[model samples]
Target chain A: MPIIINLDQVLADRNMKSKELAEIVGITEANLSILKSGKAKAVRFSTLEAICEALDCQPGDILAFSSPNPSQGGESN
Target chain B: MNLNTFFKRLIDLAFYLMVPIVVFFPGTILYVLMFPEQTIINVNIPYVENGFSGKALLFSMGFFALFLLFFAGLYQMRKFAGLLLKNKLFSQEVVKRTHKTGTFFTACALGSLIFIGINSLFSYEGKISVTFGSSNFNLLLFLLIVGVLFLLLSDAFKKALAIKEENDLTV
Candidate 1:
């Protein structure tokens, strides 16, 4: 829960639709939606590489980690 | 030669066996009920001297209900075996069938105990007391234990299926 996917922001910044990215990354739209919704348990390195290559973004630009608990003194949202 | 393959084949055998068992047992019951005198089912149990009285009919009907419940349990077992053979281990259907099997066995256990208790009460000529350590009592206890075990297994299957679904949907 601490890790958040920034795929939507990256997709928007690149002016690339999720469907187009999914096609280029060789993954289904449903899986892309899961990533976009931040519901994925763990992304494979190959998938991460494909997404980064498709959007011309770094892994850091696609994923961010913040503490989920308020007491941890990090933003959850 | 492979163990997993052998296990799967065994499950397949079990699945097929269940079909005949469910069919034959119920068919046999119907045949016996239709020709009670012709069948050996009532040979062990004593018949009323006045012939099949109201109480005898009630007893027969009760036994029929119990037999149906037993067959229903086997039916659920058949479904579970079919699913297992197909490798649909973590599906909702498997969980539901497992739960149904457990419930059916539990019902059979309770129904048998109640039937025995009522039979003993009616057959007794004098003051009533609960019988202990009888064969029927032991069978009831065994069924109760097995039924509870299956219920626990069903709960475990439910939890495992939920986790599997979550993992599958996680992408």
Candidate 2:
């Protein structure tokens, strides 16, 4: 739950539209949104490679780990 | 008795069987709504008449209504199932209402079947007898009550589910 998807940040830096990237990445808009919202249960390695190649960024630039425990200063219920 | 799941299955099966029956039986809306004076139900037996010929129109209408009910039930199942799968919506209160509604619809369907069956069984053809009786009476009341119960129940569950949705932004 704490796997942060910094998809929006990557798009902002790359000056890309989410829809365009979604199309280029061959993913549905809804699936792309799930990635954007950090609600995706898992991201395919192929999708990760596509995102990295598209934005010309390393995986670290797009994903970071966040603890789900609110006591650890991350999102929680 | 899990009326929702039970009736839901019945509704799904009935819809599959009845959709073509309802559609081909009447090509136009007006045709389905307005009863034909006399209908020959079985073609093989050149002289077999149906029970109260135009009444089959009523039966068809009832079946069509069942189709609508099935659609609505399928939709409700989809919504609740999505919520359940996504871990987004649940409350003991909601579960309780679902139980009550299952009971209500089951009771309504059963009562309708029983009353219609008994009255039709005993009554003579073309008798002005009101066994299911007076327009403002018990049968009419039961129909009205059941109809309103389903309408209100559907609306209430919708609102309750909406309230359970998480906005994430903590508004």
Candidate 3:
């Protein structure tokens, strides 16, 4: 859950539609939607590679890590 | 025929057969109780003053209740088999049915033990005898073991279903 999918941002930057990306990546629209909505449990490396190839961007451009509880920094009780 | 179709027909046949047993078994018992003389089977209690005394009726009712519990377990099994034919093995419904079946079997085993205990208490003879070597006792023990196994299986299915869902969402 902490690993955020910035697919929408990347798609927007590439000036591409979800349908177009899905067609090029050889995945169903529903799966693409799941990835975009951050509902996916995991994204396969092959899928990540395909998405990166399609959008002409790095995997970092699509994935971001954000702390769920940012204020509860490096110390544990 | 292919294995799936064969199994489907077998399950269907079993389901139909079980339906009548589930429905008519209680009805037959009630009829037998109502007209004891009309039936071949004599309803008699050993050492009781009357052939069908209040105590005898109470024991019959206890037996009936236990039978109902056993039938309920069979019904759950039927449901589970139906689901299996549909290829829905890992569904929540299957888990629930299995768990219920397990519960009914366990309850029947416990209920039988209680019935035996009560029967022993009510016997006119001063002797208290609990026969462990009887066929009925063995059957009850088997049912108890089977029930616990099913309960454990349901727990396993629950964990498997969670993992399956997670895998599905993994894309």
Candidate 4:
């Protein structure tokens, strides 16, 4: 629940647009936005690996921990 | 992938299931009218309680009504797949159809209830008793299924609509 996506900074550092990163990661622009905006509920490890590899960053650079989110604790509906 | 499209397809599948019963019920009546003595069963009359085709009608429709659940599953899968595609594989209008999923089943449920009501009102001489038949259970089951589907669709629509408000925030 505390996992964070710092894809925005990574993209900027790598001179990559969100769409470009999404294409490289085998995802969609919308999905990239969701991940970048922290609206994504879950992230596949494969996706994280792809992103890390593309931006030449470690997973630690893209992810951080914050206070637990209520929505992340359990099923919403 | 759009939630509306997913919902609409659910509606389509429900109709696919319902259309047959819709025609079958009245068609059976017409068949009966055209051939009244065709339903004959020379069972031994000893210790006989009313046995009627109303239950059969109910069960048949129950099977038909049950198909919407398959649609519901399809909708869920489609929702996930659409999300994966992020509106590229599917469209927004179609995904939101999940909002109206209830209306389709509600109409079918109503039709079923109407059928039950109509059947309840009439008992042809020598026809089976209406009190203890497969019809009664099916009536209740389809009603429950329809009610639940409506509620679920309503909830799903709310989630889909929430996106617009998020858009407002970003804009």
State which candidate has the highest lDDT.
Answer: 3
TM-score of chain B of each: 0.72, 0.38, 0.76, 0.39
- Model 1: residues >4 Å from true position, as ranges? A1-6, A15-30, A37-77, B1-47, B125-134
Q: For candidate 1, lDDT tens digit of each residue in A1-77? A: 78888988888898989889989999899998988887787688899998888888899998887986778786566
DockQ-wise, the better of 2 and 4 is: 4
Candidate with more favorable, higher lDDT: 1 or 3: 3
Sequence-dependent TM-score of model 4: 0.34
Residue-wise C-alpha lDDT for candidate 2, range B89-166, written one tens digit per residue = 455444544444444444445545654565466454765655444543465456446555655765676677555543
Model 3 residue B15 CA deviation in Å:
6.7
lDDT of 4 by residue, B1-171 (tens): 366666656656755676575556556644644564665533222212344355544544454554554445445444544444455323354345544445545555665566556654553457665566656557657655865675585566566656654653230
C-alpha TM-score for every candidate: 0.63, 0.32, 0.79, 0.34
Each model's lDDT comes to: 0.77, 0.58, 0.80, 0.59
**Per-residue lDDT of model 4, residues A1-77, tens digit only:** 46577778877888888877778889877777877887776677898888888899898888887655565463221
Q: Look at candidate 1 and tell me the lDDT of residue B50.
A: 54
Per-residue lDDT for B5 in model 2? 59
After TM-score superposition, the amount by which residue B167's alpha carbon in candidate 1 deviates from its true location, in angstroms, is 2.0
- lDDT string, candidate 3, B73-164, tens digits: 87787787778878898999989998998999899998997787677776748765566565677888898998888899899989999999
Q: Interface RMSD values for the candidates, listed in order? A: 2.0, 9.5, 0.8, 8.1
Worst 10 residues of 4 chain B by lDDT: B43-52
**For each of the candidates, what fraction of the native contacts does it recover?**
0.48, 0.00, 0.70, 0.00
